[model samples]
Target chain A: MSEKGIHIEEHRDDEASKLGMWLFIFTELLLFGGLFLVYSIYRWQYPVNFHEASLELSVTIGVINTIVLLFSSMTIAMALTAIQKNNKKLALRLIAVTLLMALIFLINKYFEWGHKFEHGLYPGSDLMALLERGHLLYFSLYFFMTGLHALHIIVGMILLIIAYFKVKKDSVNSDRFVFLENGALYWHLVDLIWIFLFPLMYLIT
Target chain B: MDHNKTHITEYKVLAKILLLLIFCTFLTISITSFNLAAFTVTIALLIAGVKGFLVLSYFMHLKYESLLLRILVGSIFLLFIIIVLITFIDYSFR
Candidate 1:
């Protein structure tokens, strides 16, 4: 009860909050699911061209980014464990590690995209206009999917940043860390998407 | 306070899961070296599906979540699969 005549209670619901996040996650899954369907249909329609284009991508960079994102997911998961145990410092450090890994993943992406750009492989480039229809579709899907994934990583970074500050302020302590949980959930979702993207975009035919 | 009792996953467990995930990734890369024909992409995607299950279950704490929540999540994936199948069926027939 407050000093004012009217009394209002503080409301908090973690399950509902988490449910909300999961619902959003479902929507996100289908959004990418649509893209995956398009990719699969095209790969079916033009297997030879898809195989050749997949060969052009750098497997080394794709593998490195895969490992980096996996490591970051582990760190973020452990950060929640740390927070659960009331180890704020360790949680902070773990989140920092995750942020660093994200930067490393982006840096690798920069080099990879930079190399492709140097060869005029990006969308709308003169060289792209001259490529076969199938190859063009492959690269177009490549850019759109990976570019959207990168944007997600940036958004996850922002959520983590907010969670970091909240943790520091003790607003999201051991008892109330749903914000952190949701952020970590988002991060894991990003990693989940990459698990499939890495192979589809870089490996196989 | 949260609804369920707090279940703090061990750091070591997360590390182990990470190791397993990395091993799966290596397997994915290793298989690409061999010319398995059309089976190659199938294997790659299968491995990816397994890896995705791990991330969803362990990393995302879906396993620890309430049964209702788990069912809801599973149903969403099921719905997505059904849509994909219908789309494919339509495309292939057309």
Candidate 2:
């Protein structure tokens, strides 16, 4: 009954894109919700073991990665501002910064996970040595949940890289900056996951 | 719209403020590791909530968006909290 658009027609594409991103965000919440439920069950069953297992994590590394992500979040905001200003060059530069920050985040995670792996702390493999007595399930969930989150981060980074190139080629504009905007939303979701993860996995002792 | 270029500079300043927030997060984590009280998780979550709001408002452009999108996003967050609250009550009783 109602029409929407720049001309006589409606901007179905714009509204659809926003709806899609929101729906994707809902699914992501549920995905992480499952992991959170598992974590909750495990912690309730074995609080002591969970406490001990948390000590094995390098908070130093986690904090560093958090800051790295925070900076990237800032860069992406700048990128969006550049887009609003129609400064494609500045937008591209900011996107490059975001991509670089993401790589650094992954690099830090590599060593963090690598350390745990070296110490025989993997999911469903050999977590007995990780905790004091009984937290195999706990550590397993930690790795599985965090591992899955890290995978999402990697995917998000690739998306940011694509956004960088797309913006560089003048493909992103006020009319079609939906891709860039949604990409930023996806990146922020990744950041939001870590915001919860940092406390749940690290500070819950 | 062209006159709003001033907001571009504001965005950069926010970026710098985010760097400071990161430093605060690092400090919070480091101090937490050194055997803080039961407030460690609370403090960490508070810092995180602040950071999340900053991103949601500034980075996601919610601040500049219409009330419709804001209501949408707010309802989602409200739903999330309600779900968590109800579940926590059930779990705690168990």
Candidate 3:
């Protein structure tokens, strides 16, 4: 047999990459899961205080944010569908809409958190110090959980922005659009967390 | 491998799912107004679970994924529930 040059191949398995993303998502779920466990324990111990503190949250703002996130999730999912169909323009527009919704969500969160700060509900504030242990824990978990969620929103937004430009550049297109799919999955996970957070924080009072 | 066979969900189906999610959100809020006492939290969490499922299945496209991925997600949730239950056992005793 004739001597042959060594051949090296680079593999790009979309399914395997998606599986990796799903695993990362599971770790995220457990991360928040631990926080939720703490919240549940505290809520169990101080139901009345938790109820009172939860009532301080604005149902209107929570509802608006929920709707906004749900709509954004829809838009991102639709964006993936658009890209898969080779409709790059539509995909970009959809992702832009999703990003806009994320901004709106953050703005609402800013106002909501600001209103709470105005009342000194944050942890370690004199007002908070005066509150009972349950109220203290409630506000503490509220800030922690929602703050972490907001941070994820910022991260997901950045991911989508990168995906947006990639789609525009044709790097993420019909033949190879795993980037958009993975980005959309992360965005939906954010929405999924909020789906639980909204009811747990605002409605159960 | 035919890696190009992407599943493209219909726009109408996505719209319908969105509408259903909105309806569920409204339902959760309306039920909260009734002050169902002990059931309030349970009901809220149940609705949220349903909403989460919709987002996972449709929005995240978990429904379209392979069995291995489904099992992996399911196992993670199962483990979370176990940990939560075990913690509750400790708290309930105290």
Measured with DockQ on alpha carbons, how good is candidate 2? 0.44
Compose the digit string of candidate 2's lDDT tens values, residues A1-205. 4365345544447556866897798789778876876677667667778888787887778777888887788788778778877888888888988988889988988898888778776765544554454467667777788888889888898888888888877787644677888898899888878877887788766
Candidate 1 runs further than 4 Å off: A1-8, B1-4
Off by over 4 Å in 3: A1-10
Model 2 chain A lDDT-worst window of ten: A2-11
- DockQ of model 1, rounded to 2 decimals: 0.78
Model 2 steric clash pairs:
A4-A10
Report clash pairs, candidate 3: none
DockQ of each: 0.78, 0.44, 0.84
Per-residue lDDT of model 3, residues A1-205, tens digit only: 2358666555789988888899899999999999999998888888888888898999999999999999999999999889888898999999999999999999999999999899777867899888888888998899999999999999999999999999989999988989989999999999999998998899756
Better of 2 and 3 by DockQ: 3
What TM-scores does chain A show, candidate by candidate in order?
0.96, 0.89, 0.94
**Candidate 3: tens digits of C-alpha lDDT, residues B1-94:** 6667767898888999999999999999998888778898899988998998888889888788788888889898899989999999987888
Better of 2 and 3 by lDDT: 3
Place model 2 in a CAPRI quality band: acceptable
List of clashing residue pairs for candidate 1: none
Candidate 2: tens digits of C-alpha lDDT, residues B18-49: 87677667766676666565576667667777
Worst 10 residues of 1 chain A by lDDT: A1-10
lDDT, candidate 1, A14-73, per-residue tens: 889999999999999999999999999899889899989999988989999999999999
| Model 1 lDDT at residue A52 | 93
